[model samples]
Target chain A: MQTLNAMPWATNFWLAIAGLLLVTLVAGLWRIWRGPTATDRMLAAQLFGTTGVGILLALSQAMQQVALIDVALVLALLAVIAMVAFVKRMQGPSS
Target chain B: MNLAFDVLLGIALLLCAAGVFYSRDLFRAVVMFIAFGLLLALVWVRLDAPDLALAEAAIGAGLTGVLMIDAVAHLSAKNAHHQGAQFDQTGARPQLWSRILPVFSAVIIFILLLGAIWWRPDAPVSLPDLVAESLPESGVEHPITAVLLNFRSYDTLLEIAVLLVAVVVAMALKPDTSEPEAGNSKDPILHGLSARLVPPMLVVGVYILWAGSYMPGGAFQGGAILAAALVFLKLAGFGIERLADSLLRIGLALGFIVFLTVATSVMIGGRPFLTYPESVAGELIFFIEAMLTFSIGLILFSLFSQAPPPVAPTSSLQGEQDER
Candidate 1:
């Protein structure tokens, strides 16, 4: 139990992850803004989805709550489905 | 103990993100996003969220990657003539304020949240304490599993519903199209290699599902692996027709149906909704998870396929090439 109180490494570990995810988010935002096509923007959105999952995991660890992980799982599931729908739309009616 | 490992993981994640964001080819960008998902999953494990790591790898990277590639293919088919057209040509939109404002705001938000967490010294510690106290009776050893299935079973049930709704909505939007002709013949070498690879992938997927009870692996991880195997087969020109048929529908519905039936039965047996009988709670949870893996895999595969129903077999193998 004393080890839990003294775990500075754990805090630092999560902070590092958070910092990196923020960097990813910034890069992804650039793609969203500068993408040359709709598909490219969607690809950027997928990047955001992955980054969001990482952030959620880091938050769950920092807060010591498992519930946040569930949120991440649900978000990942939804993001994939949405990407699929958009892909179908872009394909148009089959010739 | 190893700070270097953490640094490596962080670097990998950043690189993958950069690839995803900067790639010129949309297809390559989607592939890089999948790799980024995998790297992020590793980061989650380093952060002590293995359950999340599993879900992230499976759903975040595996399924999402498939979906993105599917969209890319669809877009390519429609916009064949406009493949390289620039999406945003606002003429090098230099935004001194717009760019600075978002970064500044994000930084402020991050700082404020961190400060609040640090400042709240007496924030309630009830959840961890409760989880520790109740874990013994949970039948499962992992705190996350206990939380997901025992303590918060209701949330898990509804989450399955959400997955089902997504699949249904995707189906509604895209009616089934005629199967693409199986195009350009696959290299015989690649086909042979895939045949050798797929069986082992299936074995590993099952092992992950079974091992989840006592270990970090679980249904989501297993299902994602299974879906990946199927995707591999589709890419290699094997099993594309079967995947789109009754098999796909069954796989998608298995988790939702099993969970709902068991949950409703619990209420019928004079317990609250989703309350598993204490004696067999662990077994029930395992069963539910197994079903979920299958369902999740199917739902994800269908989402990627985007066809309302399975495509019929064609001799040319163009469908497989199209998938690639």
Candidate 2:
């Protein structure tokens, strides 16, 4: 907590936003917990993907590590591949 | 605030893990597992290791999820008519002793880990400092890349060989059912997405491989991206397996073959197995990484492609079109 107060305001702000993203990320887990349908659960996973990218970007600013942005880039691009796999496999059985 | 974020992230990770463990639905468990991967990547980032975070992000993004989902589909397909529960996973509740025994062992392991951390000894030499000193001769500016591709390249070679063997096993386990794959999907949106994204993924794959020279990227990451693109193509009905059979085997072995060639060829010069002449070390590492990128991509894609279909012929769904 003391470390939070000692930081510059911009870093603090980004860190706070990151915390908020984490909270929403946990919130998305709700849909996963009691998903009425598999597709609904899949949507929650997608939400986690997008928010995960945002969290990385926020942390990059707070930590001032440019490498994190590259992590964010990699996450952003590869995240969709999960959906492709899901759709292809899911469709195989039902349709 | 950073601490706060880390704490919250930790809690989220625990929650996802619990979801995966306790969920009755196999699909839900898999979904929670996917969410867990993203959170884990974040955890890796907070720990200041972008290299691990990159690898986790790549694998967590899709590969494991695809394999597990394929397995779940297989299970359900096999049990399509008989089982009362379609996607429900078995073994939800175990005998009390069975559960308690695992819990007890896990606690013991946790204690041992904490004790190990508490009594950790100071090293005779600082490894990172040693790496920094030798960074110049490493053939790459990036310390991690240097260590992976140059300093400890023997480990890298063996790792590629292991991947080759794994892919080989997957290829053999693949039901020699002859590849018409239950009809390639004709989804227009999927087609559009694949057409647009695959080229960029290929570009990013090569870029990551090239970026290994100076940054937190490498052949593994690049190869993963390449594999993902191939997977995208597979999903979008690219008919990759329909290409040459022998060529696919060659592609799968290329990385290890090239790596071994480099290692043994250097031995004839009477240098240690992987020691490159100072002049060509950088070029040699780059060339090996490029071959690795292509082979690793193919190897990973083979793992996904080789999974037996969820159901046998006459799928649970409609007409089983054997397009081959």
Model 2, position B104, has a per-residue lDDT of 88
DockQ of 1: 0.06
Error of 2 at B303 (Å): 0.6
Report the lDDT tens digits of candidate 2 across residue range B1-324. 777888898899989987887666677889999999999999998898887888888878857777777776676666666645433546466677875786689789999999999999988889999999999988899999999988899899889989999988887887666658776656788789888888888888898889878888899999998888887788777778675889999999998899999988998989989998889999999999999999999999898888755553224322211110
Candidate 1 residues lying further than 4 Å off, grouped into runs, are A1-95, B1-32, B83-98, B181-187, B241-247, B307-324
Candidate 2 RMSD to the real structure: 4.9
What TM-score goes with each of the models? 0.67, 0.92
Clashing pairs in 2: none
Please give, for residues A1-95, the per-residue lDDT of candidate 2 as tens digits: 01222358889899999999888989899988866667777888889889988999888888777777767877788888878777676656344
Query: B256, model 1: CA deviation in Å?
Result: 1.0
Among these predictions, the greatest DockQ belongs to 2
